[model samples]
Target: MYILYIFRFFIQKEEGMSCCSFLDLTEADLNLMELNMDRTEFVVQEDGSLISECNDDPNASQRIRVRSDIQERRNTQSMTGTNKVPLHMFSRFGTVRATLLHRVAEGQALVLAANGSFTENNRRALMRILISELIKVHGSCYPPDEAKVALAQAIVTEFPLLRNTRTKKGYEHYYDEETRRGFIEYRLWNVRRTLSPSQKKYKTKALDSGKTTPVSPNINLLSQEELDSKIAWMKCTNPSDSNKQNIATHLQETLQNRRDWIIKKSPNISQILHEYPRLLDYNGEMINNEFRYFFKEKSVNFLARFPSYYCPRILEYAKLNRLDVYNRLKNITDVNLRALFILADLLRINNAMLAQQGDKGKGKMKGKKRQRSSEEAEMIEKEKIDVPSTFLVRFAGTPLPQSIQEASATGSIIIPPYIVCTQEENGRNSYFVQGDGWLIKPRNNNPVTAFDLLFKVYFALKICYPAGLQIFYNFIESYVYDLGTKARGVVTSLHVNLSNLKLDKIASEEFIFGS
Candidate 1:
């Protein structure tokens, strides 16, 4: 009987959210359902308390069903301007508070009769009823920010089962403070659900006409465009690259072998090495007419080492757009070395842009901006390209210089500040060793000064350490690409040699580089 009472109480209130008439369920109706009593089984005294006169009835239970009509009448009277207000009203907060208090009473009554855990459906119904009441009392712009924490508290108080548990021994941390806070925030988040324009119009039309009409059976709640967008967000359109996965299988085809071949006989590599530094500035004409092949080949080689470094689609994207490699790497004057780096960076930005666009369709972000016009909306719809879902590539790029490759391959599994012996010689190599690491320089026309050389050597020691060139490259990628434009600028401006900079010292300070 108690279980039936709890079930009916929640379902009837939940129905009120969709059809307001259910809010008028009389006390007599509740008594009939909860106590399973006929009209003769119980009587309501003048004070409105339930009583059973028949002593023959072995099971006697007293239940108090408060008048829902009181609150309904008060709400109606307020809407009709029958109640005068003071100089300052408490505003929306008062409504949320009152709704919470009412739910607490209802929840307490159910909890008293509830001996076991709540069913999932009943719990969901109760939450929906609470949310609907809050929304109703507070208007369309509901769940005012200030009341969310209090609301969560009310929920936990009413449904103690939702509370996080802590054992006496403290062996298990089932729901820590942070996680519980996240739970509260999740409940307070703005609810999103699908609603078709036709369905909404139907409801409004029925209300206005004061009559019901049969709805069209052919209406699609989810349009084809919306469905496709959702699918794109959830599934990757591009298939896995079988050729790229052959890297591990063909381990003998090392980058060292390729680099050696290029240096000895590849005329293209020879020509690029001579022209790269002198190519100096980015000239679109020069890139188009003379250097396009050089950039493509070098980029291919660089990309080979990390087989999965970029999506194959990125290359296709570049080809379709005719992205000027030299123009993009205008900041890195050592064009031969940084062309691939620039390409990788640009691809990352493009990927982020695609992800951002897809998020709008998912409605993951919230905004209060005015709606766009039909023409503007049409233009935006036309402009949105279907983005392929993707995962991080797992292939290595082209091989490094033999010495760099050997060093990198040795410490590949190590965390940063990865160090390796510069050469096979054990006796000659020492931690104090210098004059062997690579220098990272900005693209500029100025002559290489003594300070520049010193700066290069200094930063090399800080990054290279016993000497792993890959570590230096890794630092460049993470510090530059991972940072925003502003933070990247800060990194570029720190032109001073960092050879003596310690990893520990850097970690000790809080660098406000990126989120």
Candidate 2:
């Protein structure tokens, strides 16, 4: 009867649906139903008899072996065990990419599900698993170039199809050494594929059609410039009349504000570049006209690719957060530095909130405030923390230019870390400092939402700060992602202390942006 039921189970099983299909284990190896006999450890011997082992009882350790067929039992009962599973097979690693890989390895699936689309979650999971695997094979301290090569090799090994798919106009465009490194870096740094308004609309329409086509063959083929051309072509031929004038106005105002801020912040671009020489490839001898020229050259016709809806949304976030400096000063030209500043400010804000929260308990019985007992007062004092004057603000979200990372590491780049005062456990205050490391990309073409960047910076700072010390965070306002339809607030942390602090083993490997 058990064998009959097992055959029925296989008949009912969906093709390419099971995650465990990747493993080479057969029905004989995994007899799930047979585990009902006992909850303790048991070993199967050459004669297929189960031998129980119990440290508590010497007699139980050598108990008579049961001659029951374990494979037959699997059909009737579920297997239960206390041993921890490998991290790769763990529930936490059960992401879309992992699932797809598992399915493919089982030889039941060849591509992503027809109805599935490439998503940020899939990108993040791929980056995470690949990074961890690479770190395991190569040391965590592998150089950036070497790491990319290792990652590419791993990719081809895990997904053999990726190797054969490499062609000039094929889906896999990273077969070349230079392009492969860039592609790997893009994934490692969490850079996303940027789409124009029309492209996004088309994608949404496709998804709404109730049929998810297989992953697009040309999904990652287009660059930002090519997308910009598409947007321009669409605008000239089929301009969107839905809030078109408003979007254009918003874009103009935003660009003007950024330009004004650049002038205000640094009247002479050369002087500012001189102060931060690492930001520039050449010496600061370039004139303002030359700087502007270079900026124009790099920007070209790429600005049109931005989703018109994104402009108004980002603007609203800027106003709500009172980020005049960021909104006014930042543009495609200095996006990298802008991202760094944004991250730094997020850390600073979190610190201030933490400090403020800590101050609440220190009031001296003024008005309706009650005086705390000696014990409570001592506890409060213990919670009060001194903010660090300066500390390292490491970039572990996305890889930056090698020169910039080197400068940040050597203390040549002066990013003053912020501080806050609060008493909170690591788990409680973790959100303010937890990010998946997909914050900013090298180009402004694929700008991240303020909501997204805030968390990235929070995680980056979380990587730098110690958890034993109390931390705090606050979000006065939130940024809307879907044109005000959905909003997300910034997550800030409590404090920073660059003292004689020692990071726990876990903390040391938490952030790996440019490592």
Query: Which numbered prediction scores highest in TM-score against the true structure?
Result: 1
Q: Quote each prediction's TM-score.
A: 0.22, 0.21
lDDT of 2 by residue, 337-378 (tens): 233334334334333333333334333222111222233223
Task: Please report the candidate that would top lDDT against the real structure.
Answer: 2
User: Candidate 2, residue 503: CA error in Å?
Assistant: 49
User: Candidate 1 residues 4-96, lDDT tens each?
Assistant: 111111232233232223334466766675644343333333363334345454443443333555345446445335444322222323442
**Clash count, candidate 1:** 16
**Model 1's TM-score against the true structure:** 0.22
